[model samples]
Target chain A: MTMYNQTTDERVDKALANSFLRQATRRATDRLRNNKYKASAELGNWEEWRAAGEAIRKNVISNLDYYLNQLIEQMEKRGVHVHLAKTPADAVTVVRNIVSEHNAKNVLKSKSMISEEIHLNHALEEDGIDVVETDLGEYIIQIAGEPPSHIIVPAMHKTRQQVADLFEPIAGHALSSDTPTLTRFVRTQMREKFLRGDIGITGCNFAVASTGSIVMVTNEGNGRMVSTLPRVQITLMGMERIVPSFRELDILLNLLARSATGQRFSSYTTILTPPKNTADPDGPEEYHLVILDHNRSEILGDKLFRSSLNCIRCGACFNVCPVYRQLGGHAYGSVYSGPIGSVITPLLEKDWKKWGHLPYFSSLCGACSEACPVRIPLHDLLVKLRMRKTQSGHTPQVERQIFKAYRYFFTREKTLRRALRLGAHLQRPFVRNQRITGGPPPLSNWTNSRTLPMVAPKPFMQLWADLKNKR
Target chain B: MSNTSDFISNLAAKLGRPTPTQPPPQVKLSVPQYQLSSSAERVSVFLQNWQALGGKGAIVRSEDETLQCLKQWFGEQPITWFKENSKALLAWDKLPTIAESAFSSLNWPLTRYSQSAFDPRDRYSIAASAELGITGSDWGISLSGTVVVKSDPLRGRAISLLPPRHLSFIESTKIQDNLFNVLEEVAALGSPPAAIEMISGPSRTSDIEMDLSIGVHGPIEVYVIVIDH
Candidate 1:
């Protein structure tokens, strides 16, 4: 009954049938891609920026232990409490304990993928604590009782009318299906929560080691409010999210903002070294950073997959991914989605039997790798994941057999020609207007969604031979 | 209170190395240097980029012109929420003396964090209730059109964050070519401040069907007045 319980096939079928979802995703993704292109072009020297970003991330990840220790020392020195979580349950336990200690009745959260990864909201709600999602996109999906459909734009699947429908009941009046009116309602609603909420939770975009600062890049300013208003603040960080210093942050942030939202900077990029000074009038009285290491070390152990951790979660890959353009994020059936998601989900989650199929979600077009600001070779990794899945004997029997037959016939020219001739004859009954619309079980899967081109009447090799004779 | 030893040591083990005691020597990469010749160029770039981000800005010769500019700008505003008279504006104590004097000379309302008579213990309630906030910025990044505001004893973080509109004074000399230069200056200081907010423009989001909406949680309108010292 939970969010990710559906099988991959079921989710893909459901997503494919939703026309509104398709339209919304296409419009949003197209605009995001165009904006990012313009912004990066305006910045000029984008490739050099990407190279510098890659270098910085590569350095921190290679020497992760050193930088993490440095970050911990600096944070503690600034009077911020730090906790380590070895598992998802451990992370949830730490957050739950923090809430219980404060006797907090209401909790406010900004957009954090790590919180979703650990299912922190459900854990708190189970204890009868009210958890409010403060980001506009996150708030929309939160009320709809759904998981985020996109990484940055969480409610990308919902239209303006859908959002208005969700808020009208809560507002106790009729509402207009307009962006300004809907946004104003949420602003009025969240302002009260920001003032009175007992504890605030946010994800760290980049943790600077030398200064012990947790950076949050947000357009909506919810991140600022979350860190500033609550008496206590909790930051959830995946362990690999670190930079050596602010010098490196400058480089990565240049790439991040342009790649994520195509802005020079998000409206508010706040660097907080928390547990404020005693003389300061605003900010958290107690600050806690929970560093979670849920299967990231295992990813770090594999040299091929180590670079995946270098992702800044900008969601640029999602915009350019061809597979994601059609299927959207929900079909991936996980917290992370798109190319980055496909590469990391199976490696991070324990249920390989379910998550193993995620790697096959890509068309291997290499657009994700091209779009990556930190330069993760996502398509190459997807191919590698497919190899790993096959090595583990997790691929479907039909697919394995199909590949086996393909390998057998493709090795010899004569046999391939004979097979092609056989296919041409066999496809005749199914072909309608030069397209194969229906076939047996395995072929039916392909034909059900889209048409397969009928085999050539005369094989190309034979036609080439005849042309050579005529010349 | 869980220790990081196990967590960090496991990562060290995975990397086939012992836990490091010191930070690694970083490979120096060349950053893109956005070179501008003069302070005038920097201020002009800042103003241009600031307006592109939907912020209003003006360059003034002195603090006296800044006061005059504020008076004229407020007078021209279509919104009446900030001008209704009693304690509607909050300003940082670190702002130049002209700000305090402008309140009396222009008969405008202003309150500081500590001096708020509303609630002594929770004086930030004044920040929460105020319609407008005015403060002095530490630095302005001309390349990104960002104003850096660092919180201190006299400057409350809420003053820049809690209000519906924010107005900040940035000395033209404080404008820099890029964020890297500002970070370098911050690093030169021994200890960083509690919080450093780099405000690029008014709070904004395009979440509702990708329609851009201003001021979701923070200030809807932000004005940057660059003073020539």
Candidate 2:
């Protein structure tokens, strides 16, 4: 389906060339990282909280079917309509049918990565339904007709002037290129949409399985507005977004808010259970919860990538990923982007070879793993994906044989010493400025994005060999 | 819609197992660590944390004090207020005049929300025109310093969200130490409202150049009145 607009390297090149995006990413991530440091420090036992968060996520994912069903039963008991979608097509059809049934023309959505993955907006648009994004960031990107670059901050790449430029046409007048003016413009513009919207679609942050409540944490009040003002509220949740109780939520949310925006708490954290009771004056009368699998079952059973589902979509990993910081989210070429994206995108797609190259995009810095709130070992997952790719015969014959020969010699110290001696002479022609920028066929590929260090005149093994002999 | 079994069976087949008919055992986790000595201490912490979150708060001992605090914090700003009409506590002479409210949507006592759900098409302009929203909180959390608001006919969600300012009144007795405490309390009183919101501060955004902008879609200024009496 040509998911990635460009190859990874080409996309990285484009991101690197845009000095503006570089500065913006640097500033935003640094600000968030600093805020995270301060907020976490205030917790006094941040590591303990992190470990606790990881444990809860692990427990829930292990018995996902049980918890998901429990959540469904609880919601049903409360008169909530729960739908299970095994595929993207099933999910889209369910939502489309509901829209058609309600005769809903206008649909307002808050920030939802799953919605982006399923291409919900396009599906609704094809049905000729008028859809509007209510989140300030999503609203801007929707109008621009671009997918969100970052999960938390969709319009992170757009400048104030750029944002104003996008809004100026809608406002039909010149607008100031400042934060307040741009935000005020969006506030006024989206208010009418919220009041006129027939259906509100929101992403579930954490669904309390025991209580039957779907939770959403947002900085702007859009989440509250979208869920409250509309009559029919449709919540699109990834099946794995379930937690056992609010107790787990306390620890996870602390890390999520602190790590995402450095806030002690988000401005609004809403827990909506079901259809409004008779006494409840104003809320969505029709509540629909769609639990989407979308091939997540494949990852659930797989031991290597199961932990990837623990992600709360806080975008904390994206902020810390050195690769993501350099290349940006668009470079990942998936609905989900950054470290979590690399791990899940390949598993979700049927064509491993096409989407499989994503795992190799990482430099294995492990910053994302370290920054992860639930402690998903992203770098380790990447390495495992590479091994799987090679084991599946995706690696070319020449490259496989070369690696086999290298492994053979590397296992024996005698062969390694002899090979180092031979390689020192062979590399003489290629060594430039004491770095191997160019060499024979196989080694040249390694130098494409990096410079290989020149072989020392005397190998470290040899220098240490004399000392060992004396001892 | 597919039944739970079919989805579970499909997943089990992929996982190489059968769906368990028995419910999984519930695992007990540690309760959150927020130990406050008394209600007064909690409300004190709530006020501090609320201010730290960029919202304004005042702890008062009487109705007159609430009026004084309201005037001192949000003076002359038009606001729509929500309360139990069955037992009204605060007097109206001090209340600001709001141009419109959620109650203005075809009169109160919706009888059955499902039968006559809020139709956005009919009342698109009422919520957007307010400067502030005033409502009494169901409960308050001290550790997070948040006021929990339950959405009902009296207080629609838009009152706190649409306006640029929010004036929330919290009873000193309704304060809890942590989020779990509040949830446990809500559980004690069975049958949760359709929607419950734990609002910590005024609505804010950091989308543009990583700059903090308050009152983007909801109120920018939030003033909490802690009724100690």
Candidate 3:
């Protein structure tokens, strides 16, 4: 699995301690929030559009077998070879075979999150094929030997100075920490890799089932370059990335662009059919489309969490998520982080022993669902995941026992009144500034992280006596 | 790569649905309509949007005017163009020279085709030496200031992408009311073009400190010549 080296809590603690990372995340997300607000405000009826997007996604997922087969048939007619992978390992082997067929040593890529989910880069490098990331941000992180922190902006965690540092070594000289200067260097450097790459690989933003084409949107031209320059073009996409028609694609495109970057449209949006036809030139000769199911099929059966697949990977949920804003992307210990990641990670991996902690990462604030372009109920899904985890007996014994005692005392009025009367006296030692600053054992643990107002000793009775005496 | 049958069955079983061979009809609803009223109004919206998107353009009345303005824009300066005689790209009668240079003249260190040899890079050299790339738009979207280009043997994808400045010719009639209008047209095609490229503005990214930087990978400057009939 391509995840963080540390456990979720330890990673979050480390991220929180890094004041620079926290500051950067806060500044970036705040700006993103304002921009998204402005963009959606300009386009009237954004909510209606979101609802339609959600409906389109649901309709497509329910009829996925029909739509995907339709897409494959049309694609085959257009001369595109299609592959279906039941597992990540199977997907990797399918891609490996394509690379092997070309005797490909040089590979260029556009950013694909699904590829990261399968750890495609490592597999290829292990096979002795060199892979170059074409997008400017992706290239920086690739050379830095790190996965993307944010989906849209991969190097969001890195400062310009760090980017300069990363590039200077590659350039074999010193460079300035200026944005324009850094961007120029990357453009010049990656242009060579884009042109020379023998095989080009990308992730599909949305595959149009009606038209048998794949759509990609990017700010930089790397998406165009990789798909155009190489002799072979391969797009590895999740099985669910299908839109029925151009009409649906239009609305989804608007939703994705507005929710992702607060733009009316991205700088570049391309619709590519087959690699090349007999009449065309200067494009790939062979095209391959791989659809990976890899645990997503199980999600289609889940009633409460099935809508989690409606995500367009906009990263808006990350920007608005309170927990994600605090811990940053690295703390989630997965390729995907934030509310969506929390719901999908455990469900995908099925190793609740390891990834169960993720579902609890959110505050249940419902901000993620509000920010979601497709209106997925991420908070509700998180709660359901937690319930499932507890039912599986994963809840710690001490916490379960504490809750059991609270249930007992709360069920009996006499026991509750007596417990409160005694607890008021016991809480005196921990009270400071009218709040509980310290307590004993488990009580102390709660006080250390949170401040609870001490229960006032019979304040209600005192108030009633004062009113009666005045009257 | 087992047939999609197994994958489809697995998903259908999970979703508790019968295996469907054909998709259901699209659900129609009272979708909100968005449109631009007049060509003049659209032109105004397009130019305003063009500037906001970090692109520049000039509205011309005829192809001759477009050529004249383009000539005026790049007076006596050398340019690189794809096959210039196509109706899409107006023929140049007496323009600056064109280069058929191999990848050798370019400073890139890598080559995708077997025909070009690998060479070392020069830190100061640019990928495309010419300052301008000229192409034609098959259609335009006034709402978003997007020009759609189709790539083929003569019109390579690199022509519009590699240059620091890109010059695109758009027929005024080709300008649609909005992106929906554009997609509808594209969908109507019997068989869509191999590649359809939509250039909204100069390439940009805000990855570094959230600063807006334009022309990172493609043209830093773009000029759309709207040719009115």
Candidate 4:
């Protein structure tokens, strides 16, 4: 399957050319980062909390099977229907079957990255089910017929004027380019969907293994609307999204809220044990939890990449990533983006040669790793991915040839010194003021943006030899 | 439905181990704790935090003060709006007798929410139509200014959710220092209720250009009357 619509450079070029997207991403990320900094600092021991969060996630992932089993048992015990989906297609089919069995027409969805991963909306829409995205950002993107650009703020790339344009046609008239005006319009639109939606599809933030409950941390309260209003509630959960109990949840929730949106807590943290009690007034009557593997087990097996599963989907790393700051999520051309996305996309796709170039999306700066609340060593993982790509012989032929020549030359000091001596003379034509201003194909690619310092007049080894003689 | 056993077993194989029958011992990790020395500190911190989250309310020493607070809130609204509108208040049926009497005395159209009062669908629409929702919070976390509400057979979740404005009473004694303490209290119960929500503030979103918009899908305004008595 062609997951990325554009080539990597093409995508980056397109994102870079869009000045509005650049400004929007920078503004949104800066605000989010500032908020996160304040929120984490308010706790007085942010590192301790992050460490505790990392430990909890590490423990849960290490014993994922046990927790999955316990969660399934508890959910079933609570009269919730549990389905295991091994692939994206399997998950789509499960949701489709549930929709058909209930003969449901309208499906209201909250913001869920997994749902995007599984391509739930397109599949359901093809089946002629009216699926509505309830989260304001999701709703905006849904109407715009676009994929989410950011995890938390899906419409981060959209300006208020752009949003006004998107809502104008829906409202059957022009609307103002003000946040409140736009928000009120969508609120009216979504309330009808919430009340009339037959099935509520939500993404599980954390599935409590001990209690058989799904936790939703949302600011818009759409999560609550989806879970509580619809008759049939279906939660799409990645197999790794599990906490041992509510106790672990306390730590993770604190970390997630502070990291994701820089709030002491999200507006609503709903811990719902589904299939409301027999006498309960208004929660969903039928509850279904889809436990999806979708190559997560493959990731879990590779010790190097296993920690990526510990991500709470907080998107904190994205804010701190310099590459992401330059090129918004869309530039990555994956449902997941930023440093974490660079590390995992190839692993999840299992075609390093095809998706392997994603690791280059990073600058090797460890800001992502430092910003990560769960302490996923994202920068290290990206480097390892690059290494894996080379080991698997996925490097470009020209690049490989250069490396091969270097390996041969370095092995013979005489040949290396001879080649370097010749190169310094050959570069004279392109050299200007001790910098290479222009060169041929491979060299020009680097020189086009920034001049490269002429290969030092004397190689480092030669300089060392002269210094040794002077000593 | 696909069998979970095969799925889990396959995962176990990837981990280079069999699916163990027993769960590993859980490590005991200490959660970060916050403490306020006195109830006064708790109430002040909670009110301060709540206001910071765009919530408006005050601490009242007596039930009469709580009534006066609610009455003054209505007084701020133009009387004509209530007259032309439903003038309805959606409330949890089991509110403290004082709040219940206060609601009756307001002489406004009131919807007391209970499972048996209306069908499932009707409860949502009714709550959605009401101008305000009033309920009692089980606990309040002081640091975050969060109100913990439980949904059971007797109470509908929509009481605090569907309405645009929500006012809930939280007893000062029930205020906890932080979310950790409130969570510990919930876990101490045999099991979680059908649904429990830790609502920190009014529904808000910053999706469009990172502009803050309140009450996108839930209550736009939330108030908590912390009764110190």
What is candidate 1's lDDT per residue for B6-89, written digit by digit as tens? 777888899999987766888688866787999999999999999998999999876577678887878744236555635577
Residue-by-residue lDDT tens digits, candidate 1, A42-107? 877889888888989999999999889989999998788899988899999999999999999989
Flag the better candidate by TM-score, 1 or 2.
Answer: 1
What tens digits encode model 2's per-residue C-alpha lDDT throughout A31-88? Answer: 8888888887887777777788888888888778777878888998877888899888
| Ranked by TM-score, top first | 4, 1, 3, 2
CAPRI verdict (incorrect, acceptable, medium, high) for model 4: medium
Give each model's clash number.
0, 4, 1, 0
Model 3 sits at an interface RMSD, in angstroms, of 3.6
TM-score of each: 0.95, 0.90, 0.90, 0.97
Output candidate 1 Cα RMSD.
Answer: 2.6
Rank the candidate models, highest lDDT first.
1, 4, 3, 2
Per-residue error for A268 in candidate 3, Å, reads: 0.5
Who is ahead in lDDT, 3 or 4?
4
TM-score of chain A of 4: 0.98
Q: TM-score, chain B only, every model?
A: 0.90, 0.76, 0.74, 0.90
Report the lDDT of model 2 for residue A23: 86
**Winner of 2 and 3 under TM-score:** 3
1 or 4, greater by DockQ:
4
The best candidate by TM-score is 4
lDDT against true structure, model 4: 0.87
Q: Over the stretch A1-471, how does candidate 3's per-residue lDDT look in tens digits?
A: 334667766787788898878888889888887788888877788888888889899888878888888889899987898999888899999999999999999999987999888989989999999998888878888878888778887778888888898898889999999998988888888777766788999999999998789999999888888887787999999988999988788888988988888888899999998768654445678999999988898888887778888889888999999998997888888778888988898888888888888888999999999999899999999999999999998887787899899899879977776877787898888888889887676777678789898877864545688899999
